[model samples]
Target: MPVPPLPNAFLIRPIAHRALHDGNRTRAENGRLAVEAAIARGYGIEIDVQPSADGDAMVFHDYDLGRVTTATGAIRQRSADALANVSYRTGEVGIPTLAQICDQIAGRVPLLIEIKDQDGMMGSDIGTLGSSVAKVLRDYEGPLAVMSFNPHAVAEMRDLLPDVPRGLTTSDFPKKDWLLLSDARRAELASLDKVEAVGASFISHKITALDHPPVLALKERGIPVLCWTVKSAAQEIKARKVAQNITFEGYLPA
Candidate 1:
């Protein structure tokens, strides 16, 4: 099989952050309303994928279902069918499967699927979850990329679906762990798994103050960069001054 060209979305467009649920009126994170809204607005969709206890792949952002759904147990503890009826915080939206999500926006918009491994929740299995996603999305015939904070999971994805582009997530965000871990540790993780690129996730304020010269320095070498969750035109302007690849949340590109 030939390696297809990547989607040229970031060339000059902004992405819709988790389907534009719009101010928590609906469910937050990767819910139906947010995704649908993103499709309608003509922006790329960013959603998370996690393994169901039944070994199915579902669209969800958390290992624990309580925060986003009616269920209160770990996702690995419940089967996909059990989660089917559990409504998301966005009113009546239920957990969605890979098939359901792909079916909804297969051709409408590009997708960024985050394969989370927070607690190594894919269970004791290694390639099963990653390969499962690979098979399901093999014929998807749409623009997509697999991302994760876990380089090992991303590596598994690389093996399972070598055609799919992979991205690594990091905490440049004004968070506790970033302060706890040295920049050296962060750089070490960034260099893992023969990763093609990186997404620099940080608060808007922190981004402006970031070592811009070094950040774009990566992009200069053909390694594209994506900054996380910028919700304002001002922040976008600031990012444009340094890194052109800035991620946004429902904020219009003025």
Candidate 2:
């Protein structure tokens, strides 16, 4: 099948911007404040999903808990019920489940769900993060799509949730931290060389890397490119010039 179109909307609502406070006070990813903020603003929500120990798809970003929550260790170590009770450093918000987020939004706007991978960038079972997310989103009726850096996860979503659009999230290969890996290994992990094999309907690329040859090649083939984490008007301007849509936060698009 032809690649599905990117969300018709131009501005995608990133979960990071979902906070009542504008700047520094914004809570971490996948919180009530952030989800509500995006919903109230009438913007499509972009969220990350990882599975809890008990197999619930939890809306969170980091693999570790220390950065955003009062807890420590891998987020996967906690059950959804335990995570729900954990508070943010600000002490008002707790992590939410994908179901809760969907209910709160109630199809008010589009949703871009990024299924985070487990260790080794590929998950192992029904308990795998991607599988759990697919299970939760199975019945969701709304404007939604699932994308991921892990092509395997994207392919699994393709099989598990065929109706939902799926895309590949790509960044520059051999990301600074992966310089030690073989060039072939880094390229494989980046997904730039395997978009068709993974069955991606679109591409969510790192904004700064939009000019990369693979990205430009994908755009040339009429594939929609959605860029991420655009924070400033200048960056948005540059991103818009290259990408069909943008996932933005920090400030509203002009």
Clashes found in each candidate (C-alpha, N, C closer than 3 A): 3, 1
- What would the per-residue lDDT of candidate 1 be over residues 1-254, giving only the tens digit for each residue? 33333457643456666666575556466777777877777777777788888788888777788866666988877888888888766676568888788889876777877777644432224535676688788888767777776666766766677677766654443335455545665555533323443222211113544454444445566555666677898878776665555567756664
Q: For model 2, how does the per-residue alpha-carbon lDDT over 1-254 read when each residue is reduced to its tens digit?
A: 45455556523543333332244255556677777876777777788887788988888888898877778998888998889888777575568998898888777788888887664533333246677777778888778888987777888887787778889878886457555557776776664866887678788898888898888888898888888878888988898888878887777764
Question: What TM-score does structure 1 among the candidates reach?
Answer: 0.81
Deviation (Å) of 45 in candidate 2: 1.1
What C-alpha root-mean-square deviation, in Å, does candidate 2 show against the real structure?
A: 2.7
lDDT (Cα atoms) of all candidates against the true structure: 0.64, 0.74
